[model samples]
Structure formats: structure tokens, C-alpha cells
Target: EREWPLAYVPLLIDEKEWAEISAGLVQRADLFEAILADIYGPNRLIEKGILPAGLIAASPEYLRPIAGIRPASGHFLHMVAFELGRGPDGRWW
Candidate 1:
């Protein structure tokens, strides 16, 4: 596959997989929403020692210098792209 977002996925012959993929898409959206919310908020997981602080601090993907600068629309990501795959345990990854 192209690793493109679901919005860009073209029609295929796998109609039986439609419902499964749709459910996965919904779940992926929910995960993105939760991650965004946690990152910008109190961040209990990071504060409580559940997740490592280095996880965010060392990520070059997030520019920390831009914190608190809200855009006019007040949303960091007006558009988000998500791709889904499975873990070795047969669970969603």
C-alpha cells in the first residue's frame, strides 16, 4: 500500500474487509484525539512516571519552542493523517 491516509485510499475489491477497516479507522481517530489531548494538557501519564519524559523531550518531531502560541483557529493540527497496522500479538498497533 501507499501508506497514505485512509481518505486517499482508492476503491478495492475487498468489500468484506470494509466494515473491519472502518472500525479500525474510527479507533485510530480516537487514538489520535487522545494523544493530542494528553500532550497539551496536564499530562498525567508523563507527570506520574508512567511514560518517560524523554519520550516527548527527545522527539524532534515536536518543536517545543512553539508552545502556547495558538493560531487563530486554536487547533494545532487542522488535518491529521493516520495509518493502521497490527502488533506481533495480533493486537492493533
Candidate 2:
């Protein structure tokens, strides 16, 4: 097996940039939580045609057995991580 490569230099971010990134991450997490909840709960997105039923049905991540079951914590997602990279144009994408 090949060993994974590591970055020798640490990437640093300014406080202002970090603040913006953090805010965007939080917003995205909230949206993900809502989408998961909807998929496992009412599934109105499918009914309303906002999301295709076959898409969820075919998704490996979709657990049909757990549909409509509320978690004890009352939230579907507790934590999330995102991989962000800067494009050649110097914009984060």
C-alpha cells in the first residue's frame, strides 16, 4: 500500500476570511440538515416535484426503512465537513 502524502506547510487564513467561510459553512450545514429531515420525514419535496422520487429511491444513502422515524436528538445530522478548494481564478469553489 502507498502512504498518503501530507502537506509540509500549513495553510493559514485571515480572521475576516475565516469569518466568511465559517458563516457559509454554518448555512450549508443548516440546509443539509433540513434536506435530510425532509427526506426522512414528510418527503414533501418528492410529492411537490421539487425532488424526483426516483432520485431518492435510487440513492444508496437513502434508507427507506428509517423513513419517518425521528431521531432521539430530534436532528438528523449532528456534524458535517466540507472539502473546499480555490479555483485557478483565485476564487473558492
TM-score of each: 0.55, 0.84
Question: How does each model score on lDDT?
Answer: 0.64, 0.88
Candidate 2: clashing pairs of residues: none
Give the Å error, residue 45, model 1: 1.8
Clashes of each: 0, 0
Judge candidate 1 against the unseen true structure and give its global Cα lDDT, from 0 to 1: 0.64
Off by over 4 Å in 1: 1-16, 65-93
Per-residue alpha-carbon lDDT of model 2 for 1-93, expressed as tens digits? 335454668779889987988899999999999999999999889889999999999999899999989999999998898976676897666
Q: Please write out the lDDT profile of model 1 over residues 1-93, one tens digit for every residue.
A: 665444556546356666777777778777776565566655676888877879887887766756445546655555767655655785544
